[model samples]
Target: MHPPRANRAYRNVARVLRPVLYAITRRDWRGTEHLPVGSGFIAAGNHMTNVDPITFAHYLYDNGVAPKILAKSSLFSVPVLGWVLRTSGQIPVHRNTSQAGDSLRAAEQALAAGECVAVFPEGTLTRDPDLWPMVAKTGVARLALTTRVPVVPIAQWGPQLLLGRYAKVFKPIPPKRVTVVAGPPVDLADLYGRPLDAATLREATARVMAAITALLADVRGETPPERPYDMRRGGGGAGADGPAAPTADGAA
Candidate 1:
């Protein structure tokens, strides 16, 4: 397996940001052995704060896998940030439109090329009050099964200290300790080759979420709730059923 390639833009960005990130946070990253080598894979992680993505990216980059994250399309329109994202090969997700499927297709192509594709399976930051993972959209599951790629469950904590959920302030003053753990590729062998029905997707997705939640539990040194929070039924979500699951053929 060839080591993942990093473009010049990604390397330059990392060179600039890595030192600043190290200065701002005490890192406790584990499970490097779980990341797949010489192959493409999906990284499904829980979202707590806006800052977690940075920390998460730092972890993967340091481990030698340059992550291709799925970010909202709106971010690609920003001035300098957009240019960086585009040039760095990050994929844009066009939400709630006929073009929504395009993102998954792009992801599939990336995976086929042996690149790492990262996604926040929860879709948005957790609203569990205590920052536990909520019931996630099934897009991650869809991607894993359709592409038959490894789905590595990653859990991140401590970024909220830098910037709390939905908060606009970045308080990196005294610095903070950010912990991240990556679990082995989720075992979906039993479900593979089965029909991609609602039940199958939910069960597969639940496994993915559970793996992530367990890693979070390890980082937090506490037990998680009996079940993940449901953002739709609880509040602050879309239609009655929540976000629609992405199709295997590539609709997200």
Candidate 2:
């Protein structure tokens, strides 16, 4: 089905930037069909580079979904860029602040309104040196459990090669090839609505991470380590993320 055009601000910006992004990168998008249309849904993915949002958003738009991203509240405080983000439907995440609870509420309202909300569960680029998905903020699972929206576990690779994390280098040479894959919504059936306690949330969160990791492994043609890397401690092994990760970043 043809996607109705997004808001004017989003349309205008996409018209300008999508072409520029296409000119500099090759896209390998898969499983767009897995993202069900005509309803609100959560698209959760592993974060790679700073530019991953742009690439992932482009992929979503191309497949007929306008993306409303959950971004750092600080990014919305920037000058012109912040103005654009706010106007174009990005959600702001107020980390570690009292107002933090506001983000998830807003996201739930958006989902209830049938908007597709794209989330980077990692909260930041993978702290993993080799770029495997690391411990994640539990916000995604919270949103999934509460909203009962399909949590489509997605994975992205190769944008990091375009521009290394937290660096200013851009490699447009062969034009970095970016791949995004969407897996089926995770099965949180048994855990859903059990009790929003720590144990329940952790189990659901682990399922989200595992689903995302499997998709990434499929794209990379390699096995992910038995344990997800932990950012705070700088290591990964069996049960590293264990029972929890930093809890807030809600709505992921």
Candidate 3:
């Protein structure tokens, strides 16, 4: 499923961009050992900002694993970016219900071919004001169960600070340290013998998000906001909620 010339060109571009990105942010990553050394695995992460994918890709490339992302279909309609994405074999997913199956099929094929596919189980960027991850979708679980592939949970922070989630601006703030943490592989062996039901998928999604949240807590060193967006009644900000709720991974 390699894209020939497109992939080669992308590699060249990535090589050039990697150094510049590193220099600009002085980015630091941890937990590279947790990433599967080879292919046939799904990299699931919480979606916070648009730049999160690029950060993930750069981290994987630095660790010697090339990642193919399942991106929104609208991104493929861009000018040069679309060409690069198509040639580089990135999957485009249509959010519409009718075309959702196509996206899943593409993911299945990519995994079947022993390639690494990165997916954002959160579906959309987190609208949470305090930056805690939102409730995630079940797509990643569906893919993992159907393909029986290892799910590597990735947690990233600092990218949102670079390009504020709502600001659409890249601030030149100095040394805004970004961290990419990859957790150990999540095994769903117990569910292998059963069908992929809603309950199982939801459980897997929770586990994936919990892993990411733990890594994020490690990176930020602050408790995540209890509720997604810390929403409160009467459209007010996050009230003095109790301590952050425990994630499925048991991290507070």
Candidate 4:
């Protein structure tokens, strides 16, 4: 199915931010060949810095896909920026609230409508001091399993260099080098048609995180730890984890 056409509000925002990003960040984007054109799919990326959404969106926009991002609820209340985000078809996530599920429902609807939905499964910036992707929420897995759409694993490096994690200072002077790589859709066929229990969700989320970590490893040229960092436990290893290799074409 063909995704919905890009709205003018998004185009206008892109027009304004694209040149700024182009002027400041030296992009080393790869894996555009894995993006599913003309169809709805989830782009699950690692969360590094606050500026990541901008760079991630820029990459998608330049690739001819205007993403419907699942952004934090607070961002939606930030004066004029909120209005622009709402008008541009961005979904607001109300974390740790009764309304948290609202974003997931909205994301499902966006997928059904054939709109590309970008998600940061980690939900927040990595607590892993090294900026490696930490254990992520299971929302991306739930969305992929329920919607049965491709969940393309995307890893981004260097946004934290431009603007440090949770830091307010923006350093655009040196023109930081940002690398964004998109791996093929994760293979979840074995997990599909199964019950959506906690075990199932964890397995699926693990796969998503593993694929993202591998891509980031390739970009950074370093082997990842045996396990992803589990934020709940405040640690550096979630053993029993393995890489989720991409599936054959047309297999979700």
> For residue 24, what is the lDDT in candidate 3?
65
Say which candidate scores most in lDDT.
1
Off by over 4 Å in 1: 1-3, 77-84, 235-252
Candidate 3's TM-score: 0.82
Q: Which lDDT tens digits does candidate 4 get at residues 101-162?
A: 77778878888988888888776787887888888777677788999999999999988888
Mind giving the per-residue lDDT tens digits that candidate 1 earns over 1-252? 112488887888787778899999999989999999889999888888766667888899989899888877776775655665777778877778887778888889989999998888778777798899888887887788888999999999988999898888789989899888999999999999899777777778889888999999988999988867887679433211223333211124
Model 4 misplaced regions, further than 4 Å: 1-4, 78-84, 239-252
Worst 10-residue lDDT window, candidate 3: 243-252
Instruction: List model 3 lDDT by residue over 185-204, tens digit each.
Output: 88678877776676777677
Q: For residues 1-252, write the lDDT of model 2, one tens digit per residue.
A: 325638888888788777787988899999888998889998888886766777888888889988788887776765655665787778887766777677778888989989888887777778788888887767777788888989888898988888788777678787888899999889998877598776677677778889999999999999998788987677884222222212212222
**What TM-score against the true fold does each predicted structure earn?**
0.90, 0.89, 0.82, 0.89
**Using TM-score as the measure, which candidate wins?**
1
TM-score of 1: 0.90
In model 2, state the lDDT of residue 68. 83
lDDT of each: 0.80, 0.77, 0.68, 0.78
Q: Which regions of candidate 2 are displaced past 4 Å?
A: 77-84, 237-252
Candidate 4 global TM-score: 0.89
Better of 2 and 3 by TM-score: 2
Task: Identify the superior model by lDDT, candidate 1 or candidate 3.
Answer: 1
As a whole number from 0 to 100, the lDDT of residue 122 in candidate 3 is 64
Model 3 alpha-carbon drift over 4 Å, by segment: 1-6, 78-84, 172-175, 225-252
